[model samples]
Target: MSPTPQAVYLNGEWCTSDSACVSVFDRGYLFGDGVYEVIPAFAGRLFGLDEHMARLSRSLEALGIVPPLKHDDWLAIFERLLASTDAPDAAIYLQVTRGAPAKRDHAWPDASVRPGVMATVSPIGAIDGGARVITLPDERWGRCDIKSINLLPNTMARQQAVEQGCDEAVLVRDGLVMEGAATNLFAVVGGRLLTAPNGPRILPGITRGLLLDLVRRKRLMELDESFISIGALREADEVFLTSSTKDIWPVVEIDGEPVGAGEHAGRAGPITRLLDRHFQALKTRRSDP
Candidate 1:
């Protein structure tokens, strides 16, 4: 195996990953008072960069944290960081915290403190296969839309899935499926694609938006942004998850049971394959001049 990339950008300065550090009193460290966005780069091009930035801005606004850099400034920083890596396919992680306070207090600190900014790049390999998923109760806070750094609940759920030999966890709240621990969920029921409507319960994922657009344009199937009950999902013809790193991964098995109709059960269904194909084509087209 090759060594990991070490390039990182911290507060407008370039440094190695080992040299980067943040204040212990930083609000993000103390109270998870921060927001982040992950963008995938293909052939040196950052995919859905504008959308991700817009979402990041919204996350900061929701948390009442001022943006530390302008949009163009962020673009330049990401460009510089990406140029430092030789990997054609990479994932860029950008984060902003409310900054370190004079003292560790529960209350908001003075606005004079500058927000902490950090970014890093890592090589990403192609996704090779389907994923086995498990369902768990959604235990996150109400502001799931904020994309804040408070991901303890998410981490726990993902850990549970991993312990069960699964790739992801579909979080259900009150019998209704919200999303995956770190991804957006989609189910095909009766030939219609259904997903949880974006609200306070779920993060509006950029890849989810892009897939919705592609589905509409291709007219592959009926699209519905609505609630998906646990029962409905179990009875669905297909299930899939979407994220920036994992484009569109089909869920072949959920909680040890096969997904999809009997004849084509326990495998990536037809619609799932179709969407994956279209998604790859999308990447190819976007990578072209």
Candidate 2:
């Protein structure tokens, strides 16, 4: 991926980050009234375009914002952005916000208002595993599945983890493992892969979906899309989090306690490593359906 992004696309124009500015009254700025997508491109090929775009569409529709571009239009924009970047593993971060209105009114703006569109590219840097994560309350709103720009709760939780010598924050809602701050979680309990299924409590991650597919298609292990209680997750044989940028992050410790059992205890266990191996191999597929 590009070592540094030279420019960002703002309102259909390419400009440096310092020069890319949105209106102060922009709904995304004033009220976090926008949705975003973070799609990764590997080896100059866009990864999971269909899946990401589908989610983007769903988010926009859920917010009652008319989609600004068609699938082909989005693909073209992404291709152009990828061509401009130097890295073979760059992330495309794009967002659509309700445009700034004349007045900062609480009600929806008039139909004449155009949607604000912006995009940027960044390198997906190296990630060292053996992540230590802390379980915290998921205080996010009921619509966690929308992929909205509002991430204050998640940000705060992650900050707390960082201050506590941890790498990530696993959110627990109603005593059940929901997901990580910005990733989906998987726990190996009794030799079975247990992950919180896609719902209002979890943000459906592209990498999470891929890993699940890999395990199922390859019969790597018994899979279940259900919640593992926070207590069970802290005691899991293996734990991991998946994101677009940071793939399989093996959770070596949870809340200062070691993970796994037997010889694999306190380290990345066998099942997690097996899935990571297949995940790395699967990433080589230049194109995904």
Highest lDDT: give the candidate number: 1
Alpha carbon deviation, residue 212, candidate 2 (Å): 1.7
Backbone clashes for every candidate come to 0, 5
* Cα-lDDT of candidate 1: 0.91
* lDDT (tens digit, per residue) of candidate 2 on 75-105: 8788888888788799999999987898798
Among all windows of 10 consecutive residues in model 1, the one with the lowest summed lDDT is 2-11
Q: lDDT of each model, Cα atoms only?
A: 0.91, 0.88
lDDT of 1 by residue, 157-195 (tens): 999999999999999999999999999999999889999
lDDT of 2 at 243: 94
TM-score of each: 0.96, 0.95
Candidate 1 off by > 4 Å = 1-5
